[model samples]
Target: MARQTPLNEAHRKLGARMVDFAGWDMPVQYSGIIDEHEAVRTAVGLFDVSHMGEVEFTGPGALETVNALISNDLARIADGQAVYAGLLDERGTFVDDVVAYRFSPERILICVNSSNREKDFAWMKAHAQGVAPVDRSDDYAQIAVQGPKAAGLVQRLTKTDVSKIGTYRFAEGEVAGVPSIISRTGYTGEDGFELYCAAKDAVALWDALLTEGQQDGVKPCGLGARDSLRTEMKYALYGNDIDDQHTALEAGLGWIVKLDKATFIGKEALVAQKAAGVKRKLVGFELTGNGIPRHGYAILKDGARVGEVTSGTKGPSVNKAIGIGYVPAELAAEGSTFDVDIRGRAVPAVVVKTPFYKKP
Candidate 1:
């Protein structure tokens, strides 16, 4: 049996096509994948992301406790801000990628991927020095409103001044009479807010947003659109693009690692790897012709397999076939050419700058 979100019934009512994703029954598309994808690019779209997990740490040294576990420095950001980080094992490979939200020194929250919820809790519990983490996944339902007109549509219902919340920031407020944590963040590369409210309030919030946002052309989005949207932005998907086998540096997530910030879980290994240099890198590429690269497709160099595609798509927004994959650092430079074995037919491809589609 698959776990269902609070908005599962609502999604069915709205004619959503549901599919099993990470052990949850999630909507794959509402109108259509391309339609929902373009809706977010041109106007706005709503997503039910309730399956994501949340963990809270509250008590003295809670901030210090969490900071010691992840690869990013949370001390750099003030309260009400969130930082994307990696939870790594001693080998410097990812345990999971997470977003830490600092509310105060004693109370910080981490939003983790659903697939790693239990694993992360066990890992954190085993290594906790002081404050223990509490799983809050059941307590909240997350709804993402994204695109150019998202802010204005949401602002019409809430008096919290959503515009004041800059990117990577959040505030506790009432949106459509429902208490929520309005976080200025999104998986899709769009200007938007991820509204987190109580599980019981999910239906109300979802209905209100759709009713009010009708004027803004907000469509009910699903995982299919979400995957395509993130892929176009070159944002890594945990299971496909990143896993325990790949280190953060090799995954092109070096920006989140703060080496001088002192002893974190993977600091020693990351430092050693940094000194020795990453032998392979995850690189973004564009197909030269008509083939759409897919996950597990072999990446060939000089007619021999070098790596495999992790995330690939025919970008609806960019109208081009683009993909992300791992290759030797020497073959990762921009314009480096390779071949993707798509369904046993070698398709020529060229490495290019990431973020295949940039908003005009």
Candidate 2:
């Protein structure tokens, strides 16, 4: 049997179409994918992201232990700040991508993808020298309220002065009378807050927000909208766009790797790869014709397969078929032309700058 979130009943009450995602019964959409996607783009949309995992690190060696495990330098950010990072295996490939929240020198929280929760916890535990990471996945429920009008809607329920929290920052407070860690983070390429509250308070919180934000056109969004939103931003989806076989540098995530920092897992391998130069790079592209690119579609250059699409969609926001794929580093340049073999037809495409959609 698949696990269910605290808001599972709430989703069902609201007529959500549930599907099994990573062993969790999650809503794939409420009203419709395009409607929910547009709601998050122009107004606001609420997402039940309780399926994600959270692990807390504490004790004297917490800071050092966390810093050594991930790619980014957590020390660069102050308390209440979060940094996006990648967890790598010994071979320099991604074990998972995570966001580390620095609460204090002795305390930190790492939020990980739902599907990698168990594997990631084991990896962190085995590599931990002195500090142990405790899985808090069931202890909390997360709700992501996103879009242009998200802040205003959230501000009405929380007394924390939500306007003051900048991107990547969080604060501990009560939202809709429920205690929560209101973090300014989201998977969608929009300004929003990911509110983390106790599991038992999830239904109440969801009810309060939807009831209050009704007039503001807040829609109950789901996984389908989430996927399209992230795709439009070229944000990587773990199983689709990144995995254990690809290094951060090759995935266009080199910016998060701090090679100068103290030795961490995969450090030596990354240094060697950097010196050897990256052979392939991930790039974004737009189809020139009517075809929609899909995952695993062959990317052809000179009528031969040189790469393949990892994520693709007819962007709801951009109104075009866009995709992210890996190709020879030499062919990763902007304006580079290629063909995607979609349904045995060669569909022309061009490599373009990423972030297919940017907030105005």
User: What would the TM-score be for candidate 1 when compared with the true structure?
Assistant: 0.99
Please, what are the lDDT tens digits per residue for candidate 2 over residues 1-360? 999999999999999999999999999999999999999999999999999999999988798899999999888899999999999988889999999999997998999999999999999999987789999999999999998888999899988998789999999999999999999999999999999999999999999999998988999999999999999999999998889988999999999899998878889999999999999999999999878999999999888999999999999999999999999999899999999999889999999988999776
Q: Work out the TM-score per prediction.
A: 0.99, 0.99
Runs of candidate 2 with Cα error greater than 4 angstroms are none
Candidate 1 per-residue lDDT, tens place, 302-344, comes to 8899998999999999999999999999889999999999998
Worst 10 residues of 2 by lDDT: 351-360
Q: How accurate is candidate 2 locally (lDDT)?
A: 0.94
Q: How does each model score on lDDT?
A: 0.94, 0.94
